[model samples]
Target: MVNKLEVAWTLATVALIAGVAAYSTVLLYHLDALPAHPDEYVDVIGHQWFWEFCYPQNVSKVGCFNATYDPTTGATTGGHLWAAPGSVVQVNITAADVIHSFNIPGLGIRLDAIPGRVNSIAFTVPQVAAGTSFLIQCTEFCGTYHGTMRADLVVT
Candidate 1:
């Protein structure tokens, strides 16, 4: 029963399984790794249908406001995210009313904004050209106007 065909197929399956296991181990390691001390710590508080951002690391004046962005100029006019290129930005995420999710598509950040508890993720600002912008949205369905709950991360 152990013909050449059978031996070849068994070897191929073993190789495939080993490859997947190696790849998963690498991914898990990076996911759990901690970044250097964050350059800025931003508190992200989610609401029923909106997002509130506060810059607690500011020295002179701590900025806090509703998230707003300018699409044409890639500028954040309100409490939206702004960080220097190559800076580590750590976000403490939580929700006031219900469950939510804070996600940035470009940065591979997706963490739950749970009630009464805080979840955090650290992302380094990429070396983007001036005026580059990234869109962040809630992946969890909260309520009406959820589609409109969005913000922009401007690298300036």
Candidate 2:
């Protein structure tokens, strides 16, 4: 004595949900997969009020550098995140003290930097003129000077 239309509608809704779930699971898996080979690799260490960038592949000299921001001048000195234009760069991110979120709004890239844990992400640098730069910022509420925690990704 149940209504046939109701049963049909219920079954259709269940099928639609199941299909979406399966698609999402596969999409997420592929999104997290890293490339087999990248042009460059950078180690990004997040501090409470600054960011440290290290290039392990550089063998000539000590590749570690710290980026300090000057609030008065709105400039960053000491070091910068460098990459070649149109190159694929992979960044291994971690935090020294607390959790932080590394974000580059221009390229729509964001990743969490967790203490004692390394999170990796890869992206291609846009084919732009040399010296082109992007602003890097911390989206996480780290500490008192967190707002000043900024850097630049300069294309070399």
Best by lDDT: 2
After superposition, which runs of candidate 2 have C-alpha atoms over 4 Å from their true positions?
A: 60-62
Q: Tell me the tens digit of each residue's lDDT in model 2 across 1-156.
A: 999999999999999999999999999999888888998889999998899999998664258899999999999999899999999989999999999999999999999999999999999999999999999999999999999999999999
lDDT of each prediction vs. the true structure?
0.83, 0.94
**lDDT value for model 2:** 0.94
Off by over 4 Å in 1: 1-29, 68-77
Which window of 10 residues has the lowest lDDT sum in candidate 1?
68-77
TM-scores for candidates 1 onward, in order: 0.75, 0.94
